[model samples]
Target: MDLIAPVVLTRPAGRNAPLAAALRAAGLAVVEAPALKIERLAVAPPVLQVGDLCVFVSRQAVDACFDGRCAATPWPDGVRAAAVGAATAQALRLHVPADAILAPAEGAPPDSESLLAVIEAVGLVPGRAHIMRAQQGRDWLARQLQARGWSVYCHALYRRSPAIWDRDTCAILAGPGRCTLLLTSLEAVDAVADSLRRQAMDWPATLKLVTLHERIARRLQCIYADRPADALTVRLSAPDEAALFQAILASARSA
Candidate 1:
């Protein structure tokens, strides 16, 4: 494997280890620059019933929901488990049966729109639903479900706080050599931008971005609008490890 460029991973703490190790094994220099820290909130175990829908928005949600407080409780027999993306679905499999998990088809964008389509295709009757997520996030899924006559309840299991990067990490990001930053959420985009601005640094001309979704890519474009067209390069990838790996390699090759 050829060393392309340093890859900056900005996932919350403890979440970047797997990807970082994989990138390192591929011979790419990996930088652990977590842009957000996940703080699990204390919440009572969700009360689920038969014929109800249970949705997880992220892996963190799955971890938080299945934490020690609720780990011993078995999933209700008839309740359905759904995830926003394949990665979340994978995480969910640890606690639920694979057959019981509902998610977008492999390779489809792992987002609210896609997940909503899948849910509708299953022809599940409008009933009660629980959306497990952070303190704040996009409510498109919940609203969509409500519009379809489903009673939706949002459970906040955690919160995302911006992680402060040290001077050395910022230097690596702002340095001259080509660098590819993998951004998985809009919050991460803001977190990175805020960190760079706080250091009085501008977005590096050599920086390349690989975003998990188009919404996040658009957010980055808005934030870096001042940069010339040629200076900004962004690629979109499905929210899965395989897709992200390929996108990162493509960005490196383009550089």
Candidate 2:
């Protein structure tokens, strides 16, 4: 099958390389541009009271929690942690005492939605939630909790910024090719889209797009709807490598 869009993955920095390798193995070209970066915050963990809630958005956030930056302060007594995914919760096995974690059902939703379900299931009031997350991410959970008069404090565990686009990647995004592109994060899409627009992209409308969810996919469609029908959208079920690989294979096989 012809290579679909040069797949651009928007997973965290750590997962990008693996996804790229998988795409290549599936006989597809990949553009490794991280949508978000997981930067460890060099700060002392908050002094937890007797009981507090620990919240994490990704596995990276869980990694940051135990990475010495938050070492001085351990999880507060009776602080059960809630994570966005099972993968993320499992990653905390070492640092957080086992059974102190719970994640939403697999494939239910991403961070905020999962968090809300967890909070409701546990029947815990949103009191003193120490959200450990990468820098400049979605505030959906916080906003919802705050609306209900709950206390939310960011541990500010990490941050993700656009990586410098290399020469070859830039060329492909702007040049004419029968390639498809995958955009997992909205930030990554906006970043590359703007860059192409800056250079007056003459790219073919035949390019395909693989997005993680419908929201971002719709936004992108509106941005390029005037183009050819071949320039289309395929949604990945999750941000995990397996799902992404499945997306690449499917896009490549599509007529």
Candidate 3:
């Protein structure tokens, strides 16, 4: 492994292992700095079974839904499925049959706007749709659906918290640890930086950074530039780990 080429995995803990393996294959050391904490929400079986449109906001939400606490019964037949991105949409497809899945262009961020476009096509009426995602997130779709006379019920399927950095981990990131940081959310990036500062270490720019969207990419550039005008970073142009890993492999091969 490239001791100087450590990959900084800032995804959730449930997601870091696969990414770690991917970097190891590229002969790079893996320094996991998971900045997001995920917790599943509990819902009564009978109460949640009355929605026409069922949406999965993130892959984690779908996983938590089937963690042996919910009914094994198939989703309601009349229910329609929606996902935030191509990858998440694909994950939803693995279990439930999604009737209407929307995504951004292959090289763009799969955001709330893209999901809203598909929801609009369904002609959703108020109270007919149900959104399932993290404990808290953007309410744009819910508000839009309500404005369109669609009743939207958002059930918090999970909660995202920040990962607490230990002293050892803080020391590594402050140094030239050569870890590639995969940032999927802005909150996670901010958390990682805050954790480091609490440890009294400099935020070094020696590690490779991979992001899933241009907005997040720009946000990182601004934050990193504030400290060291030139920090090497790259945007993966997609909201997925596989795509980001492929981009990393290709970049390293070319370098």
TM-scores of the candidates in the order shown: 0.93, 0.82, 0.84
Local accuracy of candidate 1 as per-residue lDDT tens digits, 1-255? 224458898888887787788777777788888899999997875788999999999999999988935567777798999999988999999999888889999888889999999999999998999999999999999999999999999999999988877667777866656788988998898787788778887667656889888888788787678877866689988877777887887776674
Residue range 68-183, candidate 3, lDDT tens digits: 34456665665566777877777877667545454444654587777777667656554566777777677887887777787677877778888889878877664543455677
In angstroms, give how far residue 159 of model 3 lies from its true place.
1.9
Model 3, 12: alpha-carbon shift in Å? 1.2
Rank by TM-score, highest first.
Answer: 1, 3, 2
lDDT of 3: 0.68
lDDT of each: 0.85, 0.69, 0.68
Worst 10 residues of 1 by lDDT: 1-10
Root-mean-square deviation of candidate 2: 3.0
lDDT of 3 at 70: 47
Candidate 2 wrong stretches, greater than 4 Å: 35-38, 69-77, 174-177, 202-204
Best by TM-score: 1
Error of 2 at 178 (Å): 3.7
Output the better candidate (1/2) by TM-score. Answer: 1
